[model samples]
Target: MERKWTFLTSHLTSLNASTRPLNGQTAIVTGASRGIGAAIAVGLARAGAHVVVNYRQNAEMAESVAAICRRHDVRVLTVQADVSNAADVSRLVETTSAHFGAPSILVNNAGVAHTGLLLDMTEEEWDSIMTANLKAPFLCTKAVLPHMIARQYGRIINLSSIWGLAGGSCEVAYSASKGGVIALTKALAKEMGLSGITVNAVAPGAIQTDMLGHLSDEDLAMLAEETPVGRLGTAEDVANAVQFLALPSSSFVTGQVLSPNGGYIT
Candidate 1:
């Protein structure tokens, strides 16, 4: 399904609304030290949900994000965990619960993208992408399902990529991992639907992020020319889509991949 976006001009005015759906809830955002993940963590906090910013490295950046959330008067914590490691994921969830409460909102935004021709890629390269982009979501999702099932409400949003749908010219492994994420989202949504847990994927197209560092100026220009929106997407652009999917208003939506591609593909 197409992702719906509600654009707000400024943060100050947006937070003035009387009703906040996630005011008392807690959200855990993986890989939230920078880029899209950090944007999402801060957005959730602004909506009044306590936030756990999970990072594998970059403790300083994670703490900075947590501090931003604290300034919003929302509780924030930083946990170091590699989502691809089952043991670390378990500890991550436990720490989140102990600090705030069982997090009903989970943003599976942690991922790695490798650039190379499929023929030139090594097995280790393939494994690394799969573990972080696919297995990590599985491990983290499993860690949180029980609490969500007990409470009978939860939102699981995985960050996918337009590359997963259209396939990139030289990024076979990255594309495959995100494709698995889309499949996982669909299957798990059905499994968790009866329990009031909604699972969805957000596929972003050509977003301006550090991961796009490999793209030359010409490549970016070509992408901008290709997108109907006439510009490359920003981290905040993807974060807004995530905020919508995490809301109670999206309860009826699940088993869906919402592509925020700016008409790059239809």
Candidate 2:
């Protein structure tokens, strides 16, 4: 038998307290195997959307996230795609469209980070960072846009970084890539506004994830002290902001960057 999943429009009417605003809509989260991407996928599922968890290589972790969503009695699909590759991105979007309907929400969360001084960084290292962080979102955005335009309803959220706004030493390439993401978000939002598609970016500060483990304890402490919140931000914190942006009520808010940085750059 062919598998069938609920589409967003029809699911809205059947929504209960457990599954509200997003009833029956489909959401695709890239790099959802862990960290912020995992959090966003789970958030969308809890909000009543069938979620597609896209991962590059971490199948086990991705499957775990999908199982968690399934426990909520919602459908979750796992897809593997290197978003920076055009062919993979094409297959990813096509599979998603076949499994669910045209995805109403697309979260461009796939990215790679590298820490090294400009002089020490090799050309290969720089290229990898740029391709994953910058090119990936561009390709994924292009892949989903056609469906969005046809439906005349869509939400696209790009994951940026606080460092993208305020450059960080030893992370020049990562910062540049995220900066490109912010610019992409703004420009695309303007171009697609007439089609009822809203595009935005979120810049997050120091968040509690495996990525933070690489930092020295003293560095982490300093970051906490610098933050007005006096603590590290959680993946949940960023996820919440994304949830709000993905809502239909946020239709009027587009082309803006929501920084969940706890006043770190202000």
Candidate 3:
């Protein structure tokens, strides 16, 4: 008998119109043209938040994600900006504010990964990874923080990796960057808690995204076997965690690191 497979997007229906938790809010999801970022944008829109889909280079892909968000009957805006650049981040934030309003939710989902021996990695390569994975979050948070603080409300979610918790063998730089994200999430959570803003990080295990394109079929199978859930994670799995963190009821849950790794490292 053929086994049926469950997808991440399939869980969206579980949160219907009656349960729209983010009504009247605006959310910004960086690197949202594809994969985990796109899924989060859709999830937030489904929860009734106007979504700003921020992408670096792919306008067409961003438009596609925006179309999906529009289906949820929430406002959708697509902005092209490199999250790591301060000026670009400023423009992205200002555009969101002007078009929608101060974004109450920010998802720092833009990141880059490098796989190689630490010794073989060049300074430029390491910097690129750090800038995208670590610095981008810092820049985006700084841009949106003032508004959140002024309003005494906000939710910020950073995308971390399982490697950040348990360092990977060949992905030293990526691991370091994500670990920094986790630390930033915790420290910022403490700092922002008094202002009614919550900060959290979602660390996803191996997921079916372009990030895994470098892996072979055998490698993927081996990873699945290592996971207790008997399968790789999905973008939607991570998105669900992000949605929970973005909800107003979760205001009390701050500075937490939620990993959707399917028990891969716990």
* Per-residue alpha-carbon lDDT of candidate 2 for residues 1-266, written as tens digits (9 for 90 to 100): 12334465445555563356787889999999999999999988888889999999999999999998887667899999989999999999999999998899999999988888899999999999999999999999999999999999999999999988888888999999999999999999999999999999999999988878898999999989999989999999999999999988899999999999898887
Report the Cα RMSD per candidate: 7.0, 5.7, 8.2
For candidate 2, the per-residue lDDT at 208 reads: 85
- Cα displacement (angstroms), candidate 2, residue 171, comes to 1.1
TM-score of each: 0.92, 0.92, 0.93
Q: Model 3 segments beyond 4 Å from truth?
A: 1-18
Residue 179's lDDT within candidate 1 is 93
TM-score head-to-head 1 vs 3, winner: 3
- Please report, in order, the local distance difference test score of every candidate based on alpha carbons: 0.91, 0.91, 0.94
Error in Å for residue 138 of model 3: 0.3
Give the TM-score ranking, best first: 3, 2, 1
Question: Model 3, 60-130: lDDT tens per residue?
Answer: 99999999999989999999999999999999999999999999999999998889999999999999999
Best by lDDT: 3
Superposed by TM-score, candidate 2 places the C-alpha of residue 117 at a distance from the truth, in angstroms, of 0.7
